[model samples]
Target: MPEPVTLRPRGGMIIAAIALVIAAAALVFIAIDGGLLDLARWAWPVVLLGWGAWLLYLRPYVRVSEGFVEISNLVRTYRVPWGDIDSVDSRFALTIRTRGGRVIRAWAAPAPGARQALSTQRADVTHTPGDDDTRRPSDAEGTASGDAAGLVRRELERHRREGTAAVGQTALTWHPLLIAGTTALAAAAVVSLVLPHG
Candidate 1:
């Protein structure tokens, strides 16, 4: 079997971490400026607890091998076999179509100049179908396809035909949920300040 190929969304972890930091900072600033020391005592804990839970629960979990691809976003895990892939296409997003006619989407960072090279090479291969020496052009193509960038495209295509038997999506990152949570928590802190506390 060829070496296992694994592909993951770029900057996913970095972006998540940055967002968490920003949310935490905003919460801290509100607590200090709003004179809600008591509220901070409670709200900070909640924020910390929520942040910790998110770090533990919302992290990306993805692995790909020669035979299958596995991805987990805490809430759901998807395991797609290699045979079910139909075709892989790269545009603004990397899209994979399965044999069952479903499409899966993920962010892909296609290497600069690589796509043009691959297209040129593919065209060259298509024009010379009669070349019997498999070791020449075929080997080069295989090497390119097996590389990390190539694997991203290949896996997407594979997942389409093999059928994404075990895949799902969820808001595991600090996107809308984290932003909303922080806003609500800040609002609650403000309300707590105005209301008389027994």
Candidate 2:
């Protein structure tokens, strides 16, 4: 069996983490300089920064294994078996439609530019078979989402032909720990805002 493919927004996540670190450092400096006494004034912006950090760094990812595709967003993770997948589309989002009429979007892999997608599709159709020597890199052919979607399509097709079984029965589940952690962080942020500053 081939190794699973883990797909996430590489550049955006890195940038968001860097921004969060800078924001946090600045916050610390302000606190040491006695600017925290006026924390209420800038608290909301800090909250916004935290939210952005979570959205960018924590929100979405897709793991495609031989038998299943796991799509995780903020609170929920959907594990769809290859056999259950009706189709995969990359219109507004990287959407997977199940045979039972369930449509789940992968938050991690957002759609690429439409023009780029179209051009890549054209290239694939026009390119001759057994032309690996002439083929361009995956980056040149499509966006990250497009590349991910293609990978998923290939795996699903392979599994469909071989009649692969589901790895586990459960699907469309949430990570309780992640939910609790994020909730706690949000509550703390809110509490700090309402509480009096010393």
Candidate 3:
């Protein structure tokens, strides 16, 4: 069996992380020049931005293996076996429909903008054989959603070709740790706002 393939928005994540690091450093410098209360005030925005970056960019991903496709969302992860997948769509994002009629959207892969759609050549959108009439403008090959769908569809086709496809159930799971961490960070931000400054 081949290794699982992980797909996500690397460029955006890198940029967001770098920007946050710079902001955080600046915050630390400003806090050092001021009193302790000023540090608390500066802390929240950094914490908030860090939380946003962690949840929005660093966390979400789609992992495709020989047996299943795993979608890691904000606070939950869904594992859909190849056999359980009824169809995959790229209308707005990399959306998967299970045989049990469950729809899961991947946050990491979003469709392109108007300008991007307009710039796509025919070669960029020549995806696996499927209905073209329903295909949208942003469903180009280079777009996030389109590329992710391609990876999933290709994997699904491989299973079909090897005669290993079947019907199964999609599994859903939540991350308590993620939930707790997010709540804690949000509370800190709120506390910082309400705290009396000297």
Q: Rank by lDDT, descending? A: 3, 2, 1
Q: State how far residue 125 of model 3 sits from its true place (Å).
A: 1.2
How do these models rank on TM-score, best leading? 3, 2, 1
- Top TM-score prediction, candidate number: 3
Worst 10 residues of 3 by lDDT: 128-137
Worst ten in a row by lDDT for model 2: 128-137
Candidate 3 to truth, TM: 0.89
82-197, model 3: which lDDT tens digit per residue? 99998999877899999888999998887776787777776666664456675665566667787788888887887888988756788899999989988888888888778776
Local distance difference test, each candidate: 0.47, 0.68, 0.81
lDDT of 1 at 128: 27
Q: Model 1, poorest ten-residue lDDT window?
A: 135-144
Model 1: CA > 4 A from native: 1-8, 31-62, 71-76, 107-149, 153-198
lDDT by residue (tens digit), candidate 1, 7-46:
4433444556666777677677767876676545446444
Q: What TM-score would each prediction reach against the true structure?
A: 0.43, 0.72, 0.89
The collision pairs in model 3 are none
Instruction: Tell me the lDDT of model 3 at 98.
Output: 90
lDDT of 1: 0.47
